[model samples]
Target: MSDRRATVVRDLVRRLLDDADGAGTAPIVQVGHPVLRAAAFPCDGQLDDADLAQLVALMQRTMRAAPGVGLAAPQIGIPLALAVVEDPGVDDAEVARVRERDRLPFRVLVNPAYEPVGEDRVGFYEGCLSVVGYQAVVARPRSVRLRAHDASGAVVDEVVTGWAARIVQHEMDHLRGTLYLDRAEMRSLSATDRLGAHWASQPVPLEASRALGFALPTPAGPGGAAPR
Candidate 1:
C-alpha cells in the first residue's frame, strides 16, 4: 500500500482506540472501529512463528463460526495483514449459479494484493461481518490475479475467478483499509431482511439503484476491467 494510505489507516486506528479506551477483546470488531479501517501490517517474520500459527487457526475457526466465507485479522482486533477464507459449497443451486458460489477449501493469505484479471464484470449484493445487517450491490471484476503469502510464508500467485475471486478481493480490501461499502452502490444498499423479502431473486436491481439515487457502472466487455 502507498505511504499516504498507510498513514490514513494509522489515523483511523488511533481514533478507534481512543474511543474504546482500552476495552477488552470482542468476538469481532465492528464498523466505526479503527482496527477495521486501518491498514494491517505484513505478518511475515514480524510475529512469533508459533503465535502466528495460533492466530491463523483462531481466525479460521472464528470465520467458520460466524458462518462467513472470509475473515481478516483486523476484524478480530488484530492488526496483522492476515485473512482466512473458505466456502463449504452452497446447497441452493440457483444462488450458486448466479454468484458462481462453489466449494472452496480452507486457505490463508498474508499480506495479499490483487489486480483485475479480465474485462468481465459481475455485480452482486455483498455483506460483511463487520458491517452487519446490510447488503449492497457492488460490481467487481469477475476474475483477479492474486499475489500474497500463505500461513507458512510461502509465495502464492494465482488467477482466481468466480465467487472465490470475490471472497479474495473482499479480504484483501480489509488488509488495505477498504470496505465493501466504499465500493457499493449506495442506492442498492438494503437491510438483510429487505433483501430477503424483495430482492432475493434478483441479480443487481436497477430499481434499487434508481431509488438510491446512484448510477451503476456499465458492464465492460471481455477484457481487463479495473478493480472495484
Candidate 2:
C-alpha cells in the first residue's frame, strides 16, 4: 500500500461495519438526487460525522460500479465538497484504464483540487456513466498539475498526467454541478451521420457492434472518441 494510502479497509469495509448502524449504514445515491449534483460545498469541518463516513462508503461503491477511476461525493448526492479517487492505473501509470481492476480498490481523497499541471491540452472523447447511452467528443488538459488529500486526511500533491488527468477533470466537473454537456463545444451533429463518416477513425470493440440492433461502422484507434 502507498504510504499515503487513503485508509484501506483490506477489502469491503461495509460488511464489517454493516451492523454498526452509524458509520456503515449509508444508502446509495442516485442521479438527480439534490445532494449528488450540488456544486461548491465546504465540508472540511462540517462533514466528519458518522453519516459522512457512511456516505463516503456509498460514494466509493457507486463510483466503482460506474466503473470510474475516481468519484466525488457530490456526484453521488453527497455535497460535502470532497472526492474519492482510486488510481487503478497507478500500476500501469500509462493508459487511462482500458479495463477495470479486479482487486485492491482504493479511495484517496478528502478535499482535493484539480489544477492543471501542464499547459498542454488534448482532445479526447468522453462518456459519462451518469448521463448514459452515448459518448461525446470533448477536449481536456493532457496533464493536470494538482494537489489533493489522501484518505488518511493527508495533503498529497502530484502532477496527474495523461489519462489520470482526464479522470480528475471529469470528476471535478461533477463537483461543480457540471456535466460533459457543459464542456461539449461540438455542434450537435447527428450520431448516425458523424459515426458513419468517422467510423474509420473510431476504436470500437467487435462485441459493441450494435447500437439499437443496428451496427455503426467498426470502431477503429486513439481518435475513435469524439473530442469535448
Residues 56-174, candidate 2: write the lDDT tens digits.
67666666666766766655445545776665543542223432222334755666676775455554456666655455545566566677676556777776565666777887787
For each candidate, what TM-score against the reference?
0.80, 0.61
Runs off by more than 4 Å, candidate 1:
1-26, 203-217, 220-228
RMSD for each of the candidates: 6.5, 9.7
State how far residue 227 of model 2 sits from its true place (Å).
12
Model 2's lDDT to the true fold?
0.53
Local distance difference test, each candidate:
0.77, 0.53
**What TM value does model 2 have?**
0.61
lDDT of 1 at 14: 48
